[model samples]
Target: MMELRWLEAFVAVAEELHFGRAAERLHMAQSPLSQVIRKLEKNVGSPLFKRSTRTVELTAPGQALLPYAYRILRSLNNAMDAARSAEGVPTGRFTLGFSGMHNHDTLPRITRALRENFPGVDLNLVGGIRTFDGMRQVRNEDLDASFLGIIGDVGTPLRAREISRHHLGVVVPTDHPLAHRDAIPIHQLRGESFVMGPVDGNSSMTVAALQICHAAGFQPEIAQAVSDPFLIVSMVAAGVGITILPSEVLPILPEAATWIELEGDPVPFSHGVVWSDDNESEPLQAFLTILDSIFPEPTLQ
Candidate 1:
């Protein structure tokens, strides 16, 4: 089979019909350009050019093959472009896994960064996974990667880099007596009903809250099992119950509810970026590079 370079020379010469011009267009010496066309003609078992000192012309076979040459070269160029689309380039889509809080807290920034730098790459946001499920989805290739709030030490096959560590806090109605305090002991809430994620809530925040309550020496009275975090805050604001969440939740707390610091030794809640070890796509790699730059290890303030 003839190589692409040879066909390229043949096409250039055919189009220009002038050795000097073709050579210049190809950025090659006239002698080599002539040789490449001759080699192509020999491979095709026909003369491709009718040449003289003053000019050159494509023979009948050359004319017949010209369209084929153009098509083949065009196809090859398109194939090369397809091979280069990082995540999807020119126009590509990247699937990113995001859990509840990170959708607002983290994903928007990352998606914006990627859009600005790589406008061709669309960041597909997949949400609603609980902490551990995010890790599993990333490992299983159901998601390209995820930002998860890990509650405790959990082993995972996916690669992870913690973005932030949050100290636990209590969100209570503004009129509540404890809400006036700057900080409160977890144990002090023993008599209070808890508004929390469902017992089956997939969130690490939920697990951490339950664990903190249990560690405080009591099983909280379940005021409600609400999955929507903001709604949980609404319930608290309505005085239905108080709840424990990360300090980061302070920003989104309703006016009726406020976050109080946990007064004691801390076992922090951490949000991490997790991805499959087996994922090696160029686009995914590019996203990972950008992610590391923006959220380098232990950059928690």
Candidate 2:
């Protein structure tokens, strides 16, 4: 039987296609790496590489074995992880990032479920990170996962699973004329002054607000831009300007502002969990399993 280390060496050399670079990558001397490759080739009864003075190329047998080597290594890693989890070994700390746009009650529930299933895990919850920043963090392995309100593309090496959809609404001061109405048509707010968060390219809330306004056939007039969500809410309550927000976020604010349903077919926004597809850590896998159990399907809220 071929040893796992032999496959490891084979894969490293096969991909790098250079004994010196592969040795450097494997943290060993070039001579030993070459010996391992020679042993592997002898075991297979076929030459694996066409070695030259300046270049090393994979032979036909090496080409056939490269993919199998990758699969074996990956499977061995998964098996080790599974064994560690089954033995209840501490999976270590996990960090979750969010932008505070998700449902208020959802975070606690997710954390609680993970704790119940894996008591050995240390949980760290990070909030107030913008969606785009969170995406970058996840891709770079700074965050294990994040609750994202993605309005557009999710980018590569990262995947998203949507949990809920929210309809658009408008928030106005209680004393504002539009606040007295049960609902208002989208086009009625055409000339109205709006207060919102800064126009960061990745802010789902900002993009959703702008899209709805443009869909209504008018560009909104901006009065102020604030970074803090609560500050934006305070400005609206102080009669600085009305702003558009998802209906789910309206309930958490002070009662000084009133939420009016938007008339007409306004575009809905999505809220979901985002994580790096490349992450195969035990804790992240457990967290994802719990999240899926809690939110089996996307609900329109």
Candidate 3:
């Protein structure tokens, strides 16, 4: 039978491409590491490495087996992590990702709640450009979970639970002509130049804004495209141009800017918790439950 220990030795040597270094990394003697590789090759009935006085290299067989070895190691590590997390003690370090719509105030409350409720758990937050990358990171096991924007068509390979929604509004400079208005009609800004978010980063919002403009009979002349909300609002405050943003962002608005309710069709922004369906953890589920309770939909007055 081929031993797992031998396979691990072979993998280490294959990765390092130097037996002495691989032995040091595995904390084993070079002689034993070489013996394990030879035994592994014997069991497989093929040469896994080609070695000369000057160099050591993987043979064709080694190349083919490297990926399988990596997969096995990853699976083993994940399984161990899962088993430890399943103990229900909630004492493992986990990374949580977020992008777009997570208010600065709300995140602190969530962090405090996590600290209070799961005292044993170590939580790390990773913020990204937007939901797409956050979702990808969670699904790929780079993150334990993430808060993401629910917009356009939701992609596959990720499971999401709606946590909250906020109304969209227009942000303009305080001294701008539109600031005096309680709400602005979408059609009224048709001929004006606008500062906008990145089309790829905020694709759903960008598309919706374009469609609204198109329906109103003119295309918005985009003066600048930015990825960060703070920068976008800063540019607006400088009289660059107005932008549409979620109402929750109004509280964070710079002193030079004012927010107005959007008139006509209501464009709602949705936020959700996302995680990998295949490797759901007890800690992740607990975190999600906390989020659901904290941000329950408010009853319309």
TM-score for all models, in order of appearance: 0.68, 0.70, 0.73
Q: Over the stretch 1-301, how does candidate 3's per-residue lDDT look in tens digits?
A: 9777887898888878888899999999999888898899999899999999878899999898876775576566556656876766665666787654454756777878888988766798887536677766665576878776677555666777766677777888999888899988888887677887676754445665676678778888999998666788899999999887777676678999999887876777776667776655556766776787687764321
Q: Summarize candidate 2's per-residue lDDT along 216-270 as a digit string, tens digits.
A: 7999999998876777888999999999988777668667888999876755888
Instruction: Pull out the clashing pairs in model 2.
Output: none
Displacement of the residue 26 alpha carbon in candidate 1, Å? 44
Per-model RMSD to reference: 17.3, 8.6, 5.5
Q: In lDDT terms, how accurate is model 2?
A: 0.83
Ranking by TM-score: 3, 2, 1
Model 1 spans with C-alpha error above 4 angstroms? 1-82, 86-91, 152-156, 299-301
Native-referenced Cα lDDT, model 1:
0.78
Over 42-123, each residue of candidate 1 has an lDDT whose tens digit, in order, gives 8999998888888788889998998788668755644554586634554345678776654567777777777887776557
Task: Give the number of the best model, judged by TM-score.
Answer: 3
Candidate lDDT values, in order: 0.78, 0.83, 0.75
Q: Which ten residues in a row have the lowest lDDT in candidate 1?
A: 85-94
